[model samples]
Target: MVEHSNRKDSRAAEAHQSSCLDPFGTWKMSNAAHGFGYPSFVSYNGLEMVWAILFYVPRWLWKNWEAGKVSALRMDLNLGIISEVEKKLKKKLLIDYMYSNLKHHNFWAYRYFFCEFLSLINVGGQMVLLDRFFDGTFFTYGIEVMSFADRDQEDRIDPMIYVFPRMTKCTFHKFGTSGNIEKHDALCILPLNIVNEKIYIFIWFWLLIIGFLTFLVLVYRAAIIFSPYIRALVLRMRYRRVKRECIDMVIGKSYVGDWFLIYLMGQNIDSVIFKDVIHELAKKLGYRSRDIGET
Candidate 1:
């Protein structure tokens, strides 16, 4: 008798679950599993707007650098923490401010790296938001679409279609003339979801690409900071004409911040002129016994 009662209770629970999933199950507005994407659309649209502005900051920083006098970026006396220590050496504080915007190159480079990291975080946050919006289906969304082709068409349902259905059913209720209730089923063709489907599909793949690239940038910057050889190698690549000894000397004498500032200055100045600058910088810095690298 107890086993029979247990079975009955299990069945009741299943029925309740099914009914909860479909409040109007009797009228049968099927294909409601998507939960209509998101109950509220405001948050997801706001996240997309944030993603739009993500790349603009680094672009603006680079643009302002266009006006800097290339010759003023010279490392005449020393390197590192130019904002405070180098103020006495500044014949033209305004021009120095243009190029030596940060206290030191390491700080600028670190900030730049943080920007890359923030971009990665932004992508991850958006992906998580999308997963929550779509009820945990968005995480594997792109992978599922790619694998959709390999599966047998007989039983396979397109994830995209499942998540963003072109047609959905709605159950409507009304009162008849006899004061009795009547139910009606209606199919809705979501023309907007057709566009939405394409938009999110592109965003899914694009964000993956961007996230991967940003991660690589972070790794590359990390290597440059931790490994002196990498710093020297990158400097060599920047100006092949710059001497190997000079590159090693600069990398050894300077810390990550100083190295980074010089690196950015290299971008604005001509390579031949940059080679002379490095050569002169190394020659002058060699005479100083004080090691500011630790500083």
Candidate 2:
């Protein structure tokens, strides 16, 4: 009789425990469903649209901006230092970084070096190299881009222990075999997203405008192929430099050629309209023209 009573009480306790955990299990299931594209990460169609825009619009804008801003022009600030050893070391490290970023497929590290550290090496020739070697030897954990680099100049200047920003960040690890063999991973971290994002948006907008104008030209050409005068005018306008140079040479012997051309253009029917258009453009662009003779 006592055994039967104890068994009944044990079963009741087990039921009570399950009841207590029931709400938690339900919450966990709900969270999993939400993560799996069920109304949790996104509440409605509008939220889904936001994600779509983030994926496509931002990517398209970034591509256009990068194309417009892309240049092979490398920026190297030569400090004119007399240390050949330092120069060799710098070059080797830079090459190593490039190789690692490209060869080993470590994109994050590569971008960090090129975008952040490269821009910050503007000190008075007193250079510093922070690599995988310095990781465990000097600091506790590795430094992250957001953690080390910030919008404020104070945070940026902290890494180098100097006023200017000139130090690279990397990772190093130790492997054990017989005693210990060390493995070092070099990393580059650049905190350029905030500034780069703004610049990218501006360039992308301008590129989009340029793209539309080009499309317009193509459409106009396809429709108006038979208009000889219009076609000739369009071609001339497309490559107006030769005509502009001839006009300038004829009337700009004693004056600045561009200003002389401007004066000549000011005296024409189309030129007057163009000047007004340009003035409106300047107003829209929020820039005032400097007076002549002011540099």
lDDT of each: 0.61, 0.31
Residue 4 displacement (Å), model 1: 28
In candidate 2, which residue ranges exceed 4 Å CA deviation?
A: 1-171, 174-189, 232-295
C-alpha positional error of residue 211 in candidate 2 after TM-score superposition, expressed in Å: 0.7
Model 2, C-alpha of 139: deviation from truth (Å): 41
Candidate 2 lDDT, 1-295, residue by residue in tens: 6974454334323221211112222100012222211111123234436435533543464355334211211112034342656544543443333223322322322232232222223110111121122221122112322254653663242322211111123334456676686755443322332343344234334444544564565455344333434433442464343243322332222122222223323333233233332233223333344321111
Score residue 33 of candidate 1 by CA lDDT: 49
TM-score, candidate 1, is: 0.65
Backbone clashes in each candidate structure, one number apiece?
2, 1
| TM values, all candidates | 0.65, 0.19
The candidate that wins on TM-score is: 1
